[model samples]
Target: MANRTRTPNEGLARLLKQAKWSRSQFALVINRMGAEAGLGLRYDQSAVSHWVGGTVPNPPVRRLIVEAFSRKLHRTVTHAEAGLPLAAFDQAPPGVDTVEGIVDLGRADMDPSRRGVMAAAGLFSAGLAVPVFSAPAHATEASPVTPGKQTVRIGAGQVEAVRRMTDKIADILDELGGAHARPMAAAFLVNTVVPWLRAEASDTVKKDMWATAADLVYLTGWMAMYERDHGTAQDYYVKALKLAGRAEDHVTYCRTLRGMSLQASNLGYGPLALKLADSAAEAAPKAGPRLQAFLMGQQAHANSMVGDHRRARSLLAETEAALMKADNRRESIGGYNQSAYAFHVSHVLHEGKDLPGSISALQQALKVMPSNERQGRVHFYAVLAQRQLEYGHLEAACESWARFLEDYEHISSARGDEHFDTMRLRLKPFRKAQAVRQLSPRIADVALLKA
Candidate 1:
């Protein structure tokens, strides 16, 4: 049956219906399975339309559909039972059999609700199986263009093989995020994935490709933004948005916009940040709870950036309320929580003349953040120092600033340096005083920080 030719989306549709899933949820499940198989493909209502219109997936993807149902229903699926064509063996991409698209493709699956879908023991099991590129060649079955006499037909088997390639790419990207990972990741995105997405591919493959592209674009932009390339970061964000839109993914869209808003607010574009945040919040009401929470949190950050203390507070309170009402499965949308949100707002309050609030918020944020992230720790410390400085706690300010430098030396992350640099500038008047003068050696090495 795996080698027979058949069109089986209706069979899939029927099976999903029995599970009481809405069309959207079914699409989400399908998209997630593809992502889990490591294809990084996403689906929305538009994808459902394509499926209903006979846009049958290649054999490899069809197998993924079968697998999704099998797992969900706790039953095995036969190619024939799924209504897939027997001759679909040749319908997949070459070397696509393995699920490598899981890198970016599995991202959406990170949602809390899907956590139980795969067992912890199986986490790295897939990574170990397959020849890494065990997929076959001649697998362009997922291609959108019709095959002609001269163009050989792509079989389901061949299409399944291409999964190996995307999986390899995902692995490579993951490995490159270390000490020297940033530049390499950037090169991979610019010189490779971007070109692939722009090239000709099947709609199925294109959807898969674009989701991967969005992930890479966002990562590159984030690293570059940290390096202070605001313009480049904005370009990446724009590209990511376009790709995410093509994939019809709302969560990635929200994430890209919120990430950009953070940069804007930090760079003094408070008005722009506010606008972006407002738009995000408005669009979020229709999304998943996690996505909505994420958008709301960003909006809170934007309001605080602009010194809208009252507005920020109100939004945060609303965010907290929303979060409290949300199921545990939805928490993944806004990852860290109101702790990070509150901390950010507190910094704004401190900067805007609310000293007591800032100190209190900083203290709270530090409690929740991981101790070893280094960079975030420094920012929290710097904010604490600033609040102390503002309140005329000269000795305490000096103590906090000294501790900030300890974490600063362990990592070259720019955000940490920027915060410390700001503290240095603010502490200038007190420089010649006895306590500050004693730390002259530490102050002399300002090269690592922003001036």
Candidate 2:
């Protein structure tokens, strides 16, 4: 091979020296960061040497490098400050900058082409790990008031109205899926909620408004994830976390962190997922029983993802015990019950390779799950089909899939579509069987409709 020309990365070298990290140590930190962000990077000392020689890592990895340095120095480190080119999108802002950042995100999401760019963006582990309040002095400071605009006055009643509307929208999302309510939620945020934030109000009312906005934004993030727009979902969750922090609402902040953990775990970043889940639980030690159960259940599933079978089982038991302590108030606040616990238990068992146990837990989940949770019902049914197929029960799997299709036809979710595609591919080999033959044409019909 011809000798490769090596350029110098003086900035990276200086930073590495300041941080007192060896080439191998730097690469190891980057690898851990990548794992937290749901990326499976396998860079070694050679990768660090290449970087020192002016070879830039991929965009996501470059971000990880900056984040690692930020953590080491206990300060915000920009890409340019770390010897890298500025990213196309500005780094996510904290405190008052969060408002502007979210507005930009909303606009981008509404643009078809820009939305595609966000949808295709990779996960950033540092984004999930760092708290917004930990940014540099200016970034964490409160926003300044702008004059000359009509001072739209806001009060407690207005905040209550927004909260009630958000609750109604959340109900719709649970019953019909994000495809049916995401647009409405987005519009409400931009048109109604943003204005209230800009309006004049007492400090107490403003705090309440921020808390309510955090709730709505978090819901939007949840809907985005369900729609398979991971990047946008991450942005929304981060913004929600900032708002919750500003309002000093520990419960909402922990809930937002838990949401991030769930998204990270589902995308296969087991280590990062576990970190986020544990962080949520740690942040809310004195939370209600229902919330505790939900957080512990999430931790259990994360443990399973990382192959900690014994710990996963123990957490699952603790989750059940927590649920047993929930009263009506706790249940209403957490929005979790026996069925929710069952669903999480099923997930943990499935991840731990207990297919039979998973199937039984899923059955229990379906029996107790409320009919209003249509989207969840579809998900559970699909998983039931998958587990049956894995166990070589072709006929039973077909029956479960048929039930899934019945519910799926009414929902418009990218996740549901993905499951349908996976089912089609898996069933291809069984086409000669009577059940598969009959289901194949119907599957094709659904695909065509989706297209």
Candidate 3:
């Protein structure tokens, strides 16, 4: 037989040419897409050249290329049509892809060694511009089944049970801290929720299950943020938002965006944070009073981060006003109220360098915060100590630090540890002061243990 020559990926090249994107531009788009999907791809024109020369990209990269082209052309594109090898799961339809994605995420979360998933999970600044308010494209259809799996039955009762379990877990998260509850949350999602999602159910039951799943996933993201795993946290939040969209639960969807805003602001990505917060508020204009207060407070905090003191203060006032209109109803799935509003006030004041004002706001926060909220108490105490020290109230600072240590000793939190390290640095300047001298040994002892 005569030898045959292999053909290049002319389809991809043709698409790129039609899109008016140079090889480098196409590569840049692909790289950006990969980053948004939590993959760290460093492709340039050379990579594109290889692709055009018949070399296929990896599965994730192939999907990203198709996605990039789809975005550029404003139409859906597929791997096979793009002349790329299909992913193992690509044979399934869109709804199945979503379910499998969640399942994969849950499994990765359960395994600490899967650092790629965790690392890639960071909040991309570009995501702030993406619309999260609209319903997902696949929302109205039934989720396609995985091949060869038995059609396990699910019902509203099962979904209700999951909802109740989610409530109990959320309570535990509120009282203890994410450090204590995060593993449990991940495990539950992997072992319980993922199975329910894969099981067969009627449309109503499926929708309810998706809503409950969104709530649980949102909680997981919050816990991840608490632990300072920003990447993983961002990933979970994105998933929760998608699930919320599927369920047509606008409230949870908006709340998830707000959570993303909170994480971005905390990480000092001020501009993106402000944008996400604004989007969240705009998405849920008719939301309840507590939810409105929470969103407004988030906007205020983001404004503070971006140095818009005037806007921040105005939003803070609005947040307070909104809180007053909140009903006495039990906390909804993702609701916030007076204490949360006060805490956000403290954040804004602190960011704006109003130490005394921040301290006062934090005091109010602690006053209204639930007594059993151990993690909340610790956070308030930590901030209070820092503000007291900054205001040169050494004695009061020491007292607050003592209280912080008392609460912090029982919880594992990266945020708490960051505060502790900050306190140590702040206290170094006052080593010779009587109050500092008295508190030094205790702080040092704790630091030593942590180290």
Candidate 4:
């Protein structure tokens, strides 16, 4: 049952009038829009009447109503304008402190039922207001602490341990895939990291811990992103921002923003991605060439997608120049390398409609990619095969797909699974080709293993 008030929903009634929609008309629109999103809503005039008669819709239904009105009015609409309540996750920010919010969000994410509700609650916000990185340093003790939980004293050693664990998790993500990595990260955040954040430590140690925790949370969010649980991913990203802000760690803060930019680019929000990338670059320190390359590479990809190819090409050149000056060591948070640069080049070229150029870049990426990065190899080969097939190089595509299948079979990744399915579907028509014919038995063995 929906929570209710004795008074009518004057705000919704006003919007309905402004949209020139009758109760039945509004209900029909709501049901139709809900169906489009896979929700089986069958609301009618009476249900609309109840909503106007002081009953608030469920959280998902509230979003549906907002979407319905937004469509009818041809403008953005807000819950405040509709007189609807914000969902719990949405309410967490502004009203809650950073540490408490992180703990709460992590705990809910850890629970199966709560996580399902969060996933269904529409946690992904395209229009979410991202915080500026100019956050002033705040005292660590300002965060609300959990009562009755025992606090442990932490030092530089504890901070180093988190960094080591984060590196280990990164290795696992690269070697095995996020399916084998993210759970460990989440458990460490909830079981080990959070307590240290809430522990007895010198102010300097506490800030270090917060910054370290932010990096871990950011990685967790990145994994959630590749796993396609975008809503959950956004939750982790927001917590990462808060933690970064609390520690005044601009490096991690900008890195998180860059991560958000990549997520936006992946979701086809080109303009949004560019805005986020620009924000990261603007606030980023002159850390080193590696950091510059990392930021510029994303900016290049985003600009390319938005048809600003001139700017994109310049950024790409700058990225390559900067990367050349940097050391070969992985630069921690989502390290940028020749392989990553080559992949970015592929994205830029593909967006420019240069299919052959894109294929060549993907090949370069594969050639330079570290052999231990099985997870990345799976995606690289899958995309390379797809482009090769699209470019009418059937035999070359078959060879690439064979490579994809090899790395894919050894990894446990949701995206790798998707590509596996796509490879089979894409090859079905080419079964008569000699290369594909030769690859058939291998494909079947991998498919059966996956199944």
Clashing pairs in 2: none
Structural similarity to truth (TM-score) of each candidate: 0.56, 0.74, 0.75, 0.77
Runs in model 3 lying further than 4 Å from the true structure? 1-91, 111-131, 136-142, 148-150, 330-333, 444-451
Model 4 C-alpha RMSD vs. true structure (Å) is 13.2
On TM-score, the candidate that comes out on top is: 4
Residue pairs in candidate 4 whose N, alpha carbon or C atoms collide under 3 angstroms: none
Candidate 3 clashes: the total is 2
Local accuracy by lDDT, each model: 0.57, 0.77, 0.77, 0.82
Cα lDDT of model 1 by residue, 1-451, tens digit: 4755434377656776766666687678777776655677777877765664556766656666655665566543434445554333255432122112212222322232332342231222111111111222232432222111222223333323333333443343223222233455544543445335334655566556655556666665565466455554565666566555556555566677777777777677777877777865664436655456567777877887777778877777776667666665412122445556667668567646778888888878877765444555676788788778878888888888888877766655556657766876887887788879876678677543424
Error of 3 at 345 (Å): 1.7
Every candidate's CA RMSD: 18.9, 13.6, 11.3, 13.2
- Candidate that scores best on lDDT: 4
lDDT of 2 by residue, 1-451 (tens): 9888866888889989989999999989888877777788888899899888888876667767876885686544445656776444344222435665565566555544454577777444444444643322331133323322324788899999888888887878767777767777777787677767756777778778888888989888888887788878988988888887777778888888888898988788888889989999998848878888889999999999999989999999999998899885522123778888998898888887888999999989999988877788888889889999999999989988988887788787777888888888889889999989888777877778778
* Model 2, CA-based lDDT: 0.77
> For model 4, how many clashes?
0
The candidate with the higher lDDT, 1 or 4, is: 4
Candidate 4 TM-score to native: 0.77
**Backbone clashes under 3 angstroms, per model:** 48, 0, 2, 0
Which residue runs of candidate 2 sit more than 4 Å off their true CA positions? 1-94, 111-114, 121-128, 132-144, 148-150, 328-334
